[model samples]
Target: MKIYVVGIGAGSADGMTFEARNVLEKADVIVGYTVYAELVKKLFPEKEYFVSAMKQEAERCRKAVEMAADGRNVAVVCSGDAGVYGMASLVYEIAASYENVEVSVVAGVSAMLSGGALVGAPLGHDFAVISLSDLLTPWEKIEKRLECASAADFAICLYNPSSKKRHDYLMRACDIMLKHKNADTVCAVAKNIGRDGEEYAIMSLAELRNYSADMFTTVFIGNSMTKNIGGKMVTPRGYKNV
Candidate 1:
């Protein structure tokens, strides 16, 4: 009756936490988005699996809960930190309706954290995580958040930057940010972090509008004081400068 919700850490098998991997090895059934399921196929080659595409999130979590309700150990996998825009919340929603189902969450490295590590400590201070996907949230709300994050000078990490259906949102977001930040503000687009086709580039807020971003990309925009040194992007914590 235990359901382990494991954050698979940006779809990198190597990024899987030791505890998450142990749970995966013992799980009788695994459930996740189709792309995430495929990314971890090697770990659960012999286990029962359920994969769902976009917008079928509720159904996928229900299936996992059903299996767990039947006394099977299930692992619900999610890319990045499960709690941050991952399956953890959806799983909790379904778990609320059930009784006697033990649910545990295992943390993994999220793309935002990985991307921050790749650059410098842009996140050493306060930061905000935002998703540009308007499919679930209103565009006005997303825009408002972007404006607030920029105004606060909080380092921003963006997930689900762009897709075939929603291509111009990131550009639009940058345009809004420019009002609060300078043109020289450092930014990074970390694509497919820790996975194949992984690519990342550092640029300025002004240049962000020119890039072709995709769903796999995690964008990091520096604060007002962030700077680039020797090709590495860094947001100093004042200790170094003091």
Candidate 2:
């Protein structure tokens, strides 16, 4: 009974890691959020798929564990790295009760990495990855993280920046960062990364506050040392003058 937690990477087959593809191909059952499952389906349509709605992560992982315990090789798929705000932890938690199941995690390119590439090397130095979704986390905690990351001058990558229910969350997050960062600090929004209609834009912290983002958008806020080099957002790693 082996269960693989696979990261599919940015909703495109091109972005998937070799290890992730291999695990998905070998699995008898594929389980994930409906959107993620559909992405995997495009690559491996013959495999059995089990999909659930949003906010059903626990239920989904438990079902995957059950299927694994039934002697089926199962792969629980997620967009981006499964360990990063994905289904890996929940799968492991559920598999703990199933003594016969062995769990393996396959890494994939996360949005921060993919989005960063689209906008040059904005994350060349120290950075923080935070999620603005307050469903599982408290708003105060997210605000505090934004404040701390901004104050520390770390480039910040934000996941789940906005959704229909949380329309103003990204703006509020920007306000927090503005408290510590200059208005002209470089910032960017990477939308639909690796998928169709992919678009990205570079701007200042002040401009980003007025921008609109959705669930598919990943936001990047550059640190104090960041700058626009030839129209690309870049952060210096202090390797010069060596």
Candidate 3:
């Protein structure tokens, strides 16, 4: 049996890659976390769904792998690319014990790419993607990554910037970046990318320090080379000088 770990980009039918859509369509069962399952249900209602709540990732992957070993085509869905903070790796880890199941990953667009375009092209050059969520990782590591990314002058994309429990996480992140980045450095936020009521906020690092952000927002911090082109956040790759 083939088990496909799929990334349904941006939680929108329009945002899904053709390969991702095709795999979902071919699967007999779809398994995912509740929130991600809801997104897939809208696009493929006919398929049988097996959903679990958050923080039950291990059990969820085990169940999906067990089902696949029973000779059924199963697809496990994630919000963005399956490998990027997604269930792709976990699925493989669980599937290891079950030799009968074959696993394949179907990639999808991640928020960094989608959000990067929404606020122009902050990702035009090299960049680092970091998640501020301390659920699995410690905050100290997050701080170290921010400092390194900032000092290296790499355009940075941050995920899970803030939430009810992390109301000031974004602000703290900005403060760390500010140690190496300038106050005037351009920064932007892409809120609810590719979904309804989507919006963006572009500002300097100083303004971003006090900005209100949430889990739905993807934050961007530009390097020294990044600037505003018109009203959009942009980081040039030196094409004009060539």
Candidate 4:
């Protein structure tokens, strides 16, 4: 039995990769978080689905693996690239016990890519993608990463910027980065990326520290050379020739 871990990408057909779409289409069952389940149900309403709540990743993967072993073609769906903070790794870990099951991963555009496009090319040079949520990682570890990425001059992309309970996580991260980065360093926030109500704003690192954000927002802090070129948040690649 084989199972596909598919990245749905921004919860839209336009954002999903062709291979991801094909895998989902050919699968007999689709499994994912509740939000992702709803997103794909619109594209493939005829298929059966199994949805789990947030923080239920282990149980979710177990359910998907079980279905695949039952002679069902199962597709475990996730938003953005399956390998990037998605369920692909968990699936592999859980599927190791079942020698009969095969796992395949289908990649798609991650929020870093989709959201970066919305605000121009904030990732034109080296960059780092870090999640502000300490759900699985400790806050101290997250702080060290932010400080190091900033000191290394990598444009930084942030995920899970904020939630009701962790409202100040993004701001705290900014404070850490600011210790290495400039207060005037360029930054941007892209919300609802590749979906309705899509919007983005370019601002200074100082301004972003006070900016309101949510779980749906993807934050981008530029390297020292980043600039606001005609309303675009671009990090120059230093071509010299332009």
lDDT by residue (tens digit), candidate 2, 1-242: 88999989988798998889988888898999998999999999898899999999999899999999999999999899989998888888889999999999999899999999999998999999999999999999999999999999999999999999999998999999999999999998899999989999999999999999989999999998898988789988874622
- Candidates 2 and 4, the one with greater TM-score: 4
In order, the Cα lDDT scores of the candidates are 0.86, 0.92, 0.91, 0.93
State, as a TM-score between 0 and 1, how close model 2 is to the true structure: 0.97
| Model 3 per-residue lDDT tens digits across residues 75-194 | 999987899999999999999889788889999899998888899999888899999999999999999999999999999999999989999999999999999999999999999888
* CA deviation > 4 Å runs, candidate 2: 239-242
Per-model TM against the reference: 0.96, 0.97, 0.96, 0.98
Query: How displaced is residue 121 in candidate 2, in Å?
Result: 0.9
Best by lDDT: 4
Residue-level lDDT tens digits of model 4 in 1-242: 99999988986689998898899889999999998999999999999999989999999999899989889999999999999999999999999999889999999889999999999999999899999989899988999999899889899999999999999888899899899999999999999987889999999999999998999999999999999998889998874637
Model 2, total clashes: 0
| C-alpha RMSD of candidate 2 | 1.1
Per-candidate Cα RMSD to the true structure, in Å, reads 1.4, 1.1, 1.4, 1.0
Candidate 1 on 1-242: residue-level lDDT in tens?
78888899876777888898898899888899898898878776888888999789889999999889999999999888888888888888898888978789999898889878776666766788999999889999999999999998988889888999989988999999899989889998888788888777889988987788988888889887787877667877753574
**Residue 51 lDDT (model 4):** 93
Predicted candidate 3, C-alpha RMSD: 1.4
Off by over 4 Å in 1: 239-242
